[model samples]
Target: MADKKWMPRWFYQLASPRWCYEITGKLLPLFVIAAILLLVTGTVWALAFAPADYQQGNSFRIIYIHVPSSILAQSCYMLMAVAGAIGLIWKMKVADMVAKCCAPIGASIAVLSLATGAIWGKPTWGSWWVWDARLTSMLILFFLYLGIIALNSAIESERTAAQSTAVLALVGLVNIPIIKYSVDWWNTLHQPATFKLTERPAMPAEMWVPLLVMVIGFYCFFAVAMMLRLRNEIIQRERRSSWVRDLIAG
Candidate 1:
């Protein structure tokens, strides 16, 4: 019929800033609510339900925080880059907003990962820091995130910032792959993956389940944080527009 034919598919319709922003606005609350619930449930489960590791004992509980934050840190960077790319390529304001929003969230995860790793290391690896491939690549990732964030903020024009940061994000992406593979290639001091199923992880389910929950929780946490920041960006970027005022007034 005319109505169905008139309606454009997802990509073609999302080509509009208003469409993207409006749809995202609707979803934001859902992400936030779910994130909070999951994070709380996951944290409680990880901390309370998980059993002590055979080797690390209670110290192994650190896995809940450290591993999750580390995984989130790298994933957030890729998320940011994709946001930036969509913004630059499609000229979608919402995409740029999402990218700008990701900067601080990504940086925070990286910091959390580093901090938790350091704490875990002193006890496990007998050092607070190391120059190993895994650690060093993660460090590089942190800096790369910081650099994209700085560039996005430094520019006077929003479009220019998106374009510039997109380039940086693309370039910095190399480190993500490196970080993932470093442990295998280098035979570094860092321990191998703690939780595996088919082949069995070095650790037991007692320790792994909580860690997995925490990982899922971190994803939710990051999703909520990014959406919150993106909302703020949309408001600022669209400040002079009528839609924002309506959103605010309503």
Candidate 2:
């Protein structure tokens, strides 16, 4: 059993819906603060401080929002798939709840990514839309997120919905890499990644630093949003339990 002393206490606590709710309730404020501070600072820096692109000029500023949304959408989808797999393999209800909540948040971010991408393209490519591989793949990812959400709502049984959506999330995992590498694998108008870990950033520190801050802020925002949803899911799922009743009563 995972109850051995070698196992971490928090690892065991993750299996308990009540523990997850209480812990997230404690952590949500911290994440919210971080999200607000970083987002405000990054937005100011990106808009007022960062130098305009020589070629694209002010139009490039959209990247501060676009890049973070794109990255977060992919990350959120991966997390959803992994959480669903965990719920399937281990029968963890908390994990199931978490996977369920990830859908709408991720879908919203995906929509933001697409919208910002289109806006960016209008100035960069002189068109609002194109059949570029990167853009097409991202659209497919957005559709996949929608499909999961639809499948979950269409199913009446909660357990069946989770399992069915979990399988769909797993299958959709194939599109993530496609969305990430489409620029490289095929010739398209979309640009390659500006930030790479193995090499220094192509842009100056003033630009990249704020972008990094925004990326961190976006992740924090996602955490806050997902935790809020997960807590509500926990309460609804565990409403019959005495602890939840006590929590609600008190």
Candidate 3:
């Protein structure tokens, strides 16, 4: 009771791998349902209802996939770095697991972003690839994700691997701002951001509303994917423990 008074209940609970696994298991279904509903609705609305771009026509429909993937990829890298920091500072196993899980998911999202961006470029820029600032920075971001994944996998010791990856991730923090400001700072072929906090959106309601929905759905999907991977990591890491053995036995 006295120990409980010193620490937040949820924070303490997170230290327990079993608790984390069980809670994530309960939350997984809800995330899946929300992801499916939101994604399907947003996709249909964007593809069928949203008016085509005056400049790009049907090719612009790819923005629904491109923008969300790009946003999620960047966001996921930030989450991974934070998780790595937590694990490094507090030696939290769950945090390390989360950092590990983030790599593949984030990398996949980055790949999707690049693919969609290239496809969007073909019609708008008249090419499949170019070394433009935004595009180059985004490519670098993808390489950074891949580097973290490789670094983590190459190390043998779990603690050492986590620490190494944490340092690498922290260093990669410099790239995030670069990716965000590349278009504004350089003469890039890629367009400026469509959504801005300080300024009104460049797009009207009919175009941006479905995009908003898709962004939210993509975030939900990322959460679902991350939680699933974290749960699996917990099971694998804790397999020799009594609770895990009991869980398996049951």
> Which portions of model 3 show Cα errors greater than 4 Å?
1-7
Better of 1 and 2 by TM-score: 2
Q: Tell me the tens digit of each residue's lDDT in model 3 across 93-166.
A: 99988999999999999999999999999989999999998888889889989999999889999889999998
How does candidate 1 score on lDDT? 0.79
lDDT of each candidate versus the true structure? 0.79, 0.93, 0.92
lDDT (tens digit, per residue) of candidate 2 on 1-250: 3335776778668989988998899999999999999999999999999999989999999999999999999999999999999889878898889899999999999999999999999978999999999899889989988999999999999989999999999999999989888888999899998778889999999899999999999999999999999999999999999999998899
| Evaluation by lDDT, superior candidate among 1 and 3 | 3
Cα RMSD for predicted model 1: 3.9
Clashes per candidate (backbone, < 3 Å): 0, 0, 0
Sort order, TM-score high to low: 2, 3, 1
Stretches > 4 Å off in candidate 2: 1-7
Candidate 3: the clashing residue pairs are none
TM-score for each prediction?
0.88, 0.97, 0.96
